[model samples]
Each structure stands twice: as structure tokens, then as C-alpha cells.
Target: MLTINKDKSRREQIESVSIEQLVPHDHLVRKIESAINFDFIYDLVKDKYCLNNGRPSIDPVVLIKITIIQYMFGIKSMRQTIKEIQTNVAYRWFLGFGFSDTIPHFSTFSKNYERRFKGTDLFEQIFNKILQQAIEHGLVNMDAVFMDSTHIKASANKKKYEKVFVEEQTKTYKQALEEEINKDRQKHGLKPLDFTHEKVKLKEIKISTTDPDSGMINKNEKEHQFGYSAHIACDKNGIILSCITTPANVHDSMVFENLFNKTKKNAGKSKRAALDAGYKTPPICKLLMDEGIVPCMPYTRAQHKEGYFKKRQFVYDEYYDCYICPQGQILEYSTTNRKGYKEYKSDPKVCEKCEDLGRCTSSKNHTKIITRHVWEEYMEEVEYLRHTKECKELYKERSKTIERVFADLKEKHGMRVTMLRGIEKVHMQVLLTCTCFNMKKLANWIWKKGKGGPGKGKNLEVLLEFFSKVVLAIIKPHLSFIEKWGFVNNLKRAFARFSIFGVLLTFH
Candidate 1:
């Protein structure tokens, strides 16, 4: 209140202090410095070269550490991420950087993340790293698990596809050939081949300039879009254990079998599996039972499409082995075990003139055909799952836990479309995005622990001491104005050094 004037002597001292030390003294990113485990991932790819000639685009250890950093902080691009470590006090400290050093270019990050490390198993390595950390931290409850799948867009774009007329298809193909021919001809003067050959046949071509391998499909009765589905298996605490990717057209119901098998391998035999209505089916229920897993999928909507008494209405006669329909009609064995279970059918002669014939059979002269699986007893067990309170609670948690995995990857990690154009590339993208999700969750948990959760004061002190030393120059910008992270000075510096393509090389 007493000082209103700016004097040369007073300003000089402040200027010297500012000029001498622009970096922050207390870095907030220290909370995440030692939180994640990168060694497990580093050990997996230590000998594998990201590039040919025994050269690595990125040291496997460095790549994983930086990628985990980018995910935890929600950094948008690789270039910006590096700049953050260079200038941001918190990031620098967390990344273990010292003063008088340059941050790696954004291109370095993109190159490794999008290109070299694009393999899904590599990402799975990262995910397992965090999962092991969570297990060590006692954050994952191995007793019960809930699984559900949702669509996580591949790195492809919607603009990659457009409807083409049949007549114009050949013309388009010819034009593309002409362009390629011209380029090859003008450069190397290569001759054109015959167009009348029998090998070419396609009515319409899928042309996505951004990502060609990714197909366009509709979901939730919505407009056409490009993407893949993310299938996740998470524990009861909503901690993800495994995730897989499939084409957009692949239904969630179909992927349940393999996903269940993978989850079983990952969790071992003790955990109970929870699923949703989308997973309810006779085939899947039987498989889970064989593996000694408790099935909790809700009844399929097919059970509610009312007509002539759904399968539930057919009462079985134990002593004589037949079905008793609601109309007091006894369906005695007509075909002997042709399609598993005791065979039963209505009398065709009696059905020809029956009053309920119109509603019961597609043909007036034919009786309805119903075949039960040999494992009908397990299906009965599935039906009983709906009657319990615990099952209902598990179903409610299904949406909350699994759906958010997709939303986070798509909305935050720029995983809406795949850049690589093939099933292999798309699958890897799904795996990586899932791994990214787990690392971020673990980072947040570490921060939460430091801020005071169930743990010893001594252990917290030890963690803080170790992190503080590694991240001495971390910058913690005022939290009130953190929304400007996208345009932070460090981010701009990072991007200027590397275009998106340059960044992609770091990953591949």
C-alpha cells in the first residue's frame, strides 16, 4: 500500500532475480514424477529396435515415460508435451530435467507414439505396467470384475468416405490409374498396362484420404462416421485390466467370447465376471460356466418382444418328457433328439384347424419349431440371475465403468480415428488408447494418495522427497488459469519444432 512508484534501483533488483531464474522453484508435476512404473515397459522392448540398423527412434524407456506424462496431464500433442517438460517447472521436475537443457521436439514424441510404438502389444506392456502398479497399491479388487464394451473411434476420419455411383466407379479407378501412370511415366517413363484384364472388380471404392483402412459405419442409429469399437474388461473398482479393438461394424455381443477368455487369463480363476444385456446369450453363458465364472449378463430384449408366449411360457413335463403350452395343448415328441434336448411339437392335424394357429405358426398347416441347447440348465441359471439384487447393482455399474473408457479416449486422447489404414493398425490404436487410459488413472491415483488417502505418513514423506529431488524446476502455473494449457508458450515452442508427421515418426 505504501509503494506506488516504480524506481530504477528497486526495479533493477527484481529484474535481475527474474532474469536469473525464470524457472519455478516449486513444481506441481512432482506428484507424478515417481508415481508410474516405466521400467516394466522398458524391459519389454529393451532389445527391439524401433528403427532398422539397431537404432531406436526413441529409447524405449524414454518413450514410455514421456508418453505416460502426456496422458496423465492431458497434453494434446507431442511437440507441446516436450516443450512442457523443457519449460514447465512441474513437468521438467517430473521428467527429471535440469536447467540449461533443450526439450525434445514435438516431432520426437509423435514419431514414437504414432509410428514405432503403434503396436498394440507394446501398449499392452504399458497398460500392464500400470495394472501391476495398481495391484501393488491395492487399488484393484480381484474378487469381482465387471466388463462392458463401447465404440471408441479409430484414428480415421469421416471425410475419408463418400458415396460413388456404379457407372462412375470405373472412371474413378481409371483416373487414379492415370495419375499413378503419369507420375511413374513422367518420372521413370514407365509404360501403361492393359485395362481389359480380368482381375479388377469393385462397384464402389472406399476412399478415405486420412485413413483408408478404417471403414465407415453407423452406431446408435446415428449418422455415418469412421471409427472402431473399444472392448474393455474392468475390475469392480472400475480399473481396466484388458481392452481390445475391432472394426466399427463388429458387434459388441460377438466379441464377448474372446474378451472373456482374455480377461480370465489376466485375472486368473478367482474373479466373478459381470456383463450387461448386450452380452446375454446361450453360447456365452455356457462358456463362462465351463470356466467356472459366474455369469451376470441381463436378459436379452428378445425376451420382451411379446407374441405367442416367449420361450419362458413353455412348461416342461418331467415324467413323460414333453412341453405343456399355455393353451392346454400337450406337445409330444415328434422328432427324436434331432436338435438336442427332448423333442416336442404340436399335432399338425390338430393345429390345422386350431383357433390359435394364426398366432402360433408362420404357416397355418405347420407347427412352430423350438430347439433348446443341450445346456439348457445353464440358461435356466442365467434366467435366475435377473431375480437377484446384487446382479441389478452390477448391471447399473456396467454403463458407468465401461462407457467412460471410450469417452475418455475419444474426447481426450484424439482417438476418434486411426491414422494407419488396416485392421492391425486399428487394433493397435485401441490397445494403446486403453493403455493410455490406465496410466492416466494410475497417475491420478498417485496424486490422490499424496494429497492424503489411506497410507502411512512416512511413506508419503519418502515419495515426496524422491519426487522433489527429480523435479526441482517444475512449473505449477496458477490452477485458476490452467485452461490455457493448449496454448502455453512451451506448447507453441514444441509444435514449431515438429509438424504432425514428424511427431508420427517418433511413435512408429
Candidate 2:
């Protein structure tokens, strides 16, 4: 039975509606607004605005919120985000716009960024603020951290690159390496290698003309392209503590110190760091152990030719300072190179008479050489730690922590490929994307705890209690002086004010 009725009620419907009412109660935007405060943006950008300006400008918070929407929802472009906002009830409510209020033009954010936000650390401040909020909420666990880098394809053609010659940049650990090398040479009764008049070497690299700041990435059997690498450090809870951006050609080990130091400053010292094979170098292992942090890394396969004996087969005799080959031949140590490797050469005459000469040496002289870094002891420690129970368990969390974070950023935050050109712009993009990612996590955590709405005092009591305990623990030994100075009452008042107004209040 089909009854066709011509009803145009949709075209004639006119009932008063509230934008807030149109949005659902459990929407993500509502949770985000409830879990975090956006008022801090006013103080951060106040200097950028003119008080006695010609006209009232759009709220800087609104501009930032607009970009947040673009990344939070994985919208492809700002124009598309604007269109979505204009039609989305939840977005309109989040931005505090009325049903009929005009959504800002898509170009408004770009114009504002170029004029007010360019060359500023505004995005980084926002990211740090959000991360601090997470820390305060007890959402970050810095006991163990995971570090890695993911490549973002640059908006450039692969074939439009120009090969250019440039001076190779010196490594950050060059001075330290030279000192260690000289010390090793001194121990062996040899002269230190002179580096005073060493010339810088020139290297050829491909640069994209369209996006000169991006470097050509040609690894992992992927198509060659210009791209940028985003190095991120995350806690066990998958909360990003710090991020640094560099050209894609930069190795993970090169920027590891900067990234780790930044994370340490923000999140305090971590007990351990889990990394991949790319960060299994001597310098990295030494850096972590020197800072009293255990480094957990996977087993990196030794680089050897096919059908050749592995390096491990040669037993290193530390007492004699030599290596014993599989055929029981002693390879005596010669000299340590500037690259920090101690060379060991076998006797050509003895090797020529060996039955395994073909399998061992391909050189015309029939001599086999093996090299070991002076700092190999630190690498040995790391390899030993890799087998320990604690490190093994910590290393297993890498897939759940940093890998999951990279997947989320790419699939949910539009970080797979960046449309920006320069390193600075791409850095800002990464920061904002990570900020939004943290916000979502914070919001969901709060929501799951049954504190989802605005002004609900989300974990305020818990924070206040924790703060009181920490304060007492720090000043317990000085209680006599506090009592003598009549500060006990003042301390009580301070606690009360903290419980009321949070950390914004200070005792003067």
C-alpha cells in the first residue's frame, strides 16, 4: 500500500532554535571545551593586537579554534573547514557563534597568520600549555618514553629537484668525539690526529626547487620525494611531550639530543627511552647512559656482505686488545681512525695459507680487517639492557605508544603530507596538530571519568590533595622554622585559595 502525499513542511518550517540545543550532549567539542580552558590564548596574543585599532578584529581565540577544527576533524583544507563550520551545529556551538552569525572567511586565518602569527612562537606556547594541562591532570606517565620520527611528504614534484654541492655540516658531537679519539690514541702511545687545518668536505644532495626547505627522502624503497621529518617524544600514555621538525634527509640520531632534552625539560627526567634500530648508534647510547637514562633498543643487524661470516663470530679479547678470528688467527690492533673506530688487520701471509681465505678475504693482499668503535662498551651495555626483563617490557610498549601516536596523527590529524613549504611553517603545523591530538585525549579521559561538562571541577580536588601532599613533603623538615615565623596560618590560607582558584593564586 503506497499513499503519496505532497507535504512541503521542510520548506515552511519556522521554529525558534538554539545553536547549543542543536548540538548533542556528548559531542567531542563540548568535552574539549569542558576539559580545557581556552582563555589563556588572550594573554598569549594580547601583544599582537592593537587596543586602539581602527576596527574591532576577530577574536584570536576564534582564529585558533578555526584551525583546531581543521586538524581535529581531519578536514582537508581551510576552505572546506569553513564550509563545514558554517553548516555544522556542533562546530558553531563550539566557536560560540549564533545560528545566523557569519562564519569567518576561509582566507581570514591565513591572512591573520601571515600578519600576526608569523615568526612567533604562539603555536608552541599553545602546544606546551595543552601538554601542561595533561600533566596536571595526571594523564602523562613519564616513567618510560618512546622516541621516533615520521616523514611527511612535501608538496613538491619528485623529478623537479636540482643537485647542488654544499659543505657537510659538522655533527653536534664532533668535539666530544675528537676528545675521545685523542684519549684513545694517547692510551695506545700514538700521536693525536691533527684536525686544526682539516678542510670541510663538500657533498652533493638533491633539493626541490618548489619547496627548497624540504629534503629529498630516498630510503626504505619508497619513491623519492621531497619531505620533512617530524621527531616526536611521547610518554607511556602516548602523550606527546616534545616535537622537533627537520628536513627529511636528517637522520633520527642527529636530532635526538635536542628532542630528548626538550622532552626532559618539559616532562622532567624519564627513567628509560625506547628507540628503534636507527638510534642504536654509539653516541646515542652514550648520551642516554650519561644522563642516567636506560636506553632500550632492538637488535640491529650487523652490516656484512651476503655469504660472509658475521662480525660476532670473531671473539674480541679485551685482555690482549685484539680479535681472535674463527680460524684462531690473532688480528692485532693497528690505529684508531678519526671516525672513532679501532682498526685490526690480520697477517696477509698467514691468511693466504688459510683454507677459508676465499670465504674471509676478497682483497688482493688476502688480509681481513675488522673495526670497532672506541665507545663500543656503551653499545654493549645497551645490547645487554635489551635482554633485561624491564627493558624488554619497556621496548614492547613502543608499538602501543609512539607508533600509535604516528598513526593517529596521520589518519586523524591530516599530518600524512603537509602543504606548507618552509621548515618553520611545517613545524607550526605539527605543533598545532599535536596540540589538538592532546586536547582530544584529555577530553576523552575526563569524559570517561564522569566529569564531562563545563565548570564541573574536573579532578580539582584530586589535584589539590596531591599538591598539599607534595608541599608537606618538601617542607616537613622546616616545620619548626615555619611555626616560629607564624606561617602555619598563612600556609592554610594559601591552600584554601589554591583549592578555590587553582594555581593562579600566589602567596605573597
Q: lDDT per model, in order? A: 0.61, 0.90
Per-residue C-alpha lDDT of model 1 across residues 1-508, encoded as one tens digit per residue = 6977666686446332322255342223433444654566656766555445754354566666676566555565556677777766555555555565566676775566555555547766656666777778888776667777665455566765665433322331233434444453343343444445535454564545665545456756887776667678888666778777766656666777677667767655534667776766666677777777777777665443346657657787757757777677888754423223434688778777677766676754578555554456677797897678876776677667666665676678766644545667556555656666766666567767665323436675676566544432232333224335543454445544444323322321
Per-model C-alpha RMSD: 19.5, 9.9
lDDT of 2 by residue, 1-508 (tens): 9998799787888988777788888899989888888999999999999999578999998999999999999887889999999999899999999888999999999899899999999999999999999999999998999999999999999899899999886788999999999999999999999988888899999989899999999789998889999999999999999999999999899999899889998889999999999999999999999999999999988889888788889999999999999999999999999899999999999999999888887889898999999999999999999999998898888889999999999999999989778999899889999999999999999887765465465578678777667776666777778779987777666666465333322332
Instruction: Give Cα distance to truth, residue 418, candidate 1, Å.
Output: 5.0
| TM-scores for every predicted model | 0.68, 0.87
Off by over 4 Å in 2: 1-6, 451-508
Sliding window of 10 residues with minimal summed lDDT for model 1: 165-174
Worst 10-residue lDDT window for candidate 2 reads 499-508
Candidate 1, residue 502: how far the Cα is off, in Å: 60
